[model samples]
Target: MLSFARAEGAMGAFSASGTLAVMLDRNAAVILVNEPAERLFGRDLWVTGRHLACADKNATDALRRAFHVLLRNPTPPAMLNPVPLPRLGGRPLLAYPTRLPRITTKAHPVR
Candidate 1:
């Protein structure tokens, strides 16, 4: 049962081709990403070691707020507004962020 559960969980993460799972550090830096996430963020793999803030100020701000909220409750998925990614040839993407426990700060009540 455990083995089946583990496999199912792993498969779930890769179930969607264009979907992404982004891991952010405390300083708002990209820590880890799956292959699909790399394509989704587009060219961001080149800037992986840098702060997400350097990519796009507007997106950075939005990400910060969403990160904070996620750290607090770690529930209720947040939808990141669609934005034009110029580095990716001005392609539009809607990033839906889910707050995972390890990537978040201390847990708090959701308001």
Candidate 2:
């Protein structure tokens, strides 16, 4: 899995193939490069801290709802159902959610 760490932001770990992945943080932002994903959806100009839905109203609303699902589940979700991007003047892409591992607060002992 792609292990990325941002001390003040979030962590998204995906496999080498990039098929199965997980995103954890207050922001539900991501970067994608599929032809359809790029053509239908907008790209993050800054390359960071930008979600595809920010510019698209429909994606924004759907993403908001997906966040709600995470909010309701304190234990974190086991899986994220796919969310289709708005197509009719909407973000033209499909987003699928995959559950991330539970974060544990264990400390490593120094020898």
Candidate 3:
């Protein structure tokens, strides 16, 4: 499995890979994108704050539903295959929704 010490590191790795990669937050908003992904999607604009569903209205409803399910139950990653990319000649693509590790906080008692 691919691992990154930080989100920036992950983005750097993704940018280096030839395959398209995208990282989304629990809210389904894009958090990271790579060069291949930008070329595949044919846009140079910033996508970090944009929701994936905004690209294709036909899949918006279903994508939102899947996002909700993933948020509710995030133990195992969710996969969405054959996703239609209307902007890319309606080409099908695969998407994975994985949960990011949470940071724990604990109060320490002073002696």
For all candidates, the clash counts are 0, 0, 0
**Model 3: per-residue Cα lDDT at residue 78:** 44
Off by over 4 Å in 2: 1-15, 20-24, 27-50, 87-91, 103-105
Q: In candidate 1, residue 30 scores what lDDT?
A: 65
List all candidate RMSDs to the true structure: 7.9, 6.2, 5.3
Candidate 1 stretches with Cα past 4 Å from truth are: 1-12, 15-18, 25-29, 40-54, 74-88, 100-111
Task: Estimate, for each residue in 6-78, the C-alpha lDDT of model 1 and write its tens digit.
Answer: 4345435754654556555555566555666566544542454464432566765675676666555446455
Report the C-alpha lDDT of model 2 over 1-111, residue by residue, as the tens digit: 223333212322233333333344546555334332333333421123554454456666776688667745677676577776545453444566554453434566989
Question: Scored by CA lDDT, what does every candidate get?
Answer: 0.52, 0.48, 0.57
Q: Estimate each model's TM-score.
A: 0.50, 0.50, 0.58
Question: Residue 9: error of model 1 in Å?
Answer: 5.5
Question: By descending lDDT, how would the candidates be arranged?
Answer: 3, 1, 2
Model 3: lowest-lDDT 10 consecutive positions: 40-49
lDDT of 2: 0.48
Supply the global lDDT for candidate 3: 0.57
